[model samples]
Target: MKITSIKLPGDISDESLEALGNDLENNSSTLDIEIPLNELQSSLELNNQQKDLAGQISNKAPRVIYSTSPSILVVIDGEPKIQQNAKWGVEAVVNTPFTLVKSGGSYYLHGGKHWYVAPSAKGPFSMTTTVSSQLRKIEEQSKAEASSENDAAEKDENTIYKIIVSTQPAELIQTNGEAKFASLENTGLLYVSNSSDDIFMDVDSQNYYVLISGRWYHSKTLSGNWEYAASDRLPDDFAKIPEGSPKDHVLASIAGTDAATDALQEAAVPQTAKVDRKSTQAEVTYDGEPQFQDIDGTELDYAVNTPASVIRWRGRYYSVDNGVWFESGRATGPWVVSVNRPYAVALIPPSYPVYHMKYVYIYDVSPDYVYMGYTPGYLNTFVYGPTVVYGTGYYYRPWFGTHYYARPYTWGFNVRYNPWIGWGIGYHYSSGWFNAGFGIGHRPWGYWSGGWWGPRSYRPAYCWSPNRYGGSYYGRNTVYYNRSRNYNIVNRNYSGNIYRNRGGIVSRDYRRADFNNDRYRNNRNPSWSANRSNNRYNDNRYSDNRNDNRNSRYN
Candidate 1:
């Protein structure tokens, strides 16, 4: 039994429904995609659009796009926060045309349904595409199975904190097993722990940057640039933390003196000489930073590995997870870092930026920022500098279209193809038919034609590549010229139906799925969805009619 799916306009004939399914099975995936003659011919004839000498868009092989497909069990491998904020992993399928992916051992059903892995190899895993009585039962089953699997499987190392600083001037740490850096400052420590562990971390030291990257800096270190006292947060109270690790539910009051030895004295004076003592449990951690002074702390809770020298942001004590000392503000969080600083700092309202930047670390002090840099034998300079070994993305911050991504140039096209099949189809149909269907883009795995101008065989050879050889895209209005209301239609193709390629990859534009998650990926032409909000034309009705392909190949 081959499984087929379709989304119809509320009411559809059994014939049309059967036709759609057969079309998918016969023409698409060999695993079981069918198609009918009527829809197939109509779809093909609709694809070939004869414009400036045959525009871009030719047939290419479709891929095996298997969405959750009402599967039995969706195994989340060790639970690594699959639906993370696009910082760790790609977006799991939340909707149709889901990109094939797995996270935390479980796959995201079209991006949402969380299914668990089965125990006995593959006993059972099923769900319902439609929201009916059976669907609810299956959904529960899936959840139960997942929970069982979670209990049995070994989880990913979430919130790992190794003793980065070992009572030495130089100590290193790692983030989510990725980046690495040294907490050179005598006073430095990372705080915060959550369920997910594959978090990246880094210390943003943009302010103290000297001759770090390629650019030769006149300054040297943080102490040279900013106000570096003997210690930043050392206070005038009892100092020196106890030797053992912090146990749970123990009201441990730590204090900080200007000097470690001095702080130790204050600790000795203790209840005898202390004045204006905190009536509450609000005791300071090392270096005078206040932690849950009131929270009862038993000794077995935290393995007091290193001294406390954390960057206090907002009210949370954020620490890096790995080698790269990134930053966080929540103090308590699944911090998604914005900046992967080998050394970054947090700035306050009265922030005194020792260097030229804002808010200290990047990305709202989320979790540990993954360092996008080069490894020793992995990165160097061949063009920029003979020995160029500078950081690239350190300063490059691209938001989801809100920030500027690395856009050297942009290519646009008008997919001028007709969607309707007048009298017949196929060879006699001629003039307009696209391989990947009529309306698609080279960016979205659609074909490219240099507008019958560039090299005839101008196929993209690289990934994340734009068709520079010369090509054009057709607009949804290509069929009716903005006048025909009966235009937007999806019929059928000969060689397996349309399939989804990868989305939300690394792109020059932040809004480009290259950078954004599928949650932000743009659906093609969109006007036919019957919803006004789904219409792309509403935003640029006038500009599109002129020539979106940039090459001016079409009217």
Candidate 2:
């Protein structure tokens, strides 16, 4: 029998409910993505808006745009961080995601397939046939590095995308030539079939709609300025998008829909644990000395120079590593498992960089053990209003002092949510999505992997990589993003204590048949469940671990 769906009773016991959640988590893998040819062609072909923006920036010296087809967007912060390429006697642009080098007053950007050149650091770059011996050596080294990445899955040259170089934040939205609309059966909405962006048009209003992070934005036309369309104000047909339709995924962004409701219920379910304080220890490393930044509306200060989510409140320093909380007196510490986290942590708003830490909780504290759990929000999945959203829709600037400490971003990488993979990046298929081939170690993955801080001994048991092009280097190995589930907190395994050998991994061992034997399985404790204050938000609106009222915040 094909089990289409199973309807469990709403009043299921906590243990049975979490056991089912474990089953779902174990069985679920990332959605294998294949980008449409139209979307791929559209990304390569710049629209009038992009062209106008390029022209506007051309007047600004060393702040120009470079265009290439099916290319990865290489973003640089302010001036390029140039480092000595002593082997080739060239200065390499070390800070950006891709490999860019300066040789003889000209800049060359290598995009795995082709190298682009221009007169300045930033440029109206164009393809050049002429190549210097030094730059050619760099290209050879890059290819050799790509070859050694995963021999079984070597990147084909045909799959290589050209490069798009940008100094400021920019996202590409293009329709392959002109916009093509496809009508949905029995629905009054027409969706743009030629674009990767979730675009739709209401037949009644003739207004264009776009979905981003579960928020609806509307415009009179595709090129016009957009305004937010509240979920409640959206047309009734948005909720009626039929299941399995090409644009049916948009239903999750619509309030009161079955898809949105399912997402909300899933968002409340957490991966819980009984932590042994004596055995579990969290280590935090700073780039240089420890630095702190105040979280808006909270008295607490978070460590901005470290990847480990550490906060200082009332002179006490606390760190949440992998779902386990640890505390110490000093910023750098002989850390011990924490019994109680700061109450002020819940006051953290979406704007704060460490706002995700608010989702990490401490439920009960005994002498030797502290019961703790973290919701999907800790992994950047949040229950926003009536539906669940991937990110907070706020851009947290990455710290680039001595070492780069990257914060979770809302844009740049096209982020989308799938029930199977949680939040994954959506991009033109086969396009080099942050395919950093220049230097192996100095990539965006390394910065995001908490290279600046974390439990040093921990590593992932396995990697769940469904998308070949989404592969990113984490630590020493190539861990591919099923969108952006790379280095996910839920993907790790735990033994004696949760934080003991906590490492970066997407452990396939987590998918075992026996949920009872899984150390990291969702555990529900009677003590914690009764005292739910630990998981409560300031407004007492929703429970992080339990299903709340079905009232739609949008309505």
Off by over 4 Å in 2: 1-72, 83-95, 99-112, 119-121, 127-163, 273-279, 364-370, 429-555
Model 2's lDDT to the true fold? 0.54
Instruction: Note the residue pairs that clash in candidate 2.
Output: 424-483, 424-484, 425-483, 425-484, 458-502, 458-503, 459-503, 460-505
| Model 1 residue 479 lDDT score | 23
The TM-scores, one per candidate, come to 0.14, 0.64
Q: What is candidate 1's CA lDDT for residue 48?
A: 31
- Give the per-residue lDDT of model 1 (tens digit) for 1-555: 363433332234446667878876676655554667765664444333111111111111111111111111122112122232232133332111112224344332311242222112121322224343433443454334333322211121121111110111110111223222333222232211210111111133223211121121211232232121122122211122112211100001121212222212211110000101111011112212223221121111110111111344334344322111223344333343223331212111111111111111211111211212111111111011112211121211111111111110001111111112111111101111112211111222222211110111121110100111111112111221112331222222211101111121111110100111111123221111111211111111122111212312210
Whole-model lDDT, model 1: 0.20
Q: Number of clashes in model 1? A: 101
Q: Which regions in candidate 1 have their CA more than 4 angstroms from the true location? A: 1-330, 333-555
Model 2 lDDT per residue over 306-363, tens place: 7677899889898887777788999999898776666666666666667677677665
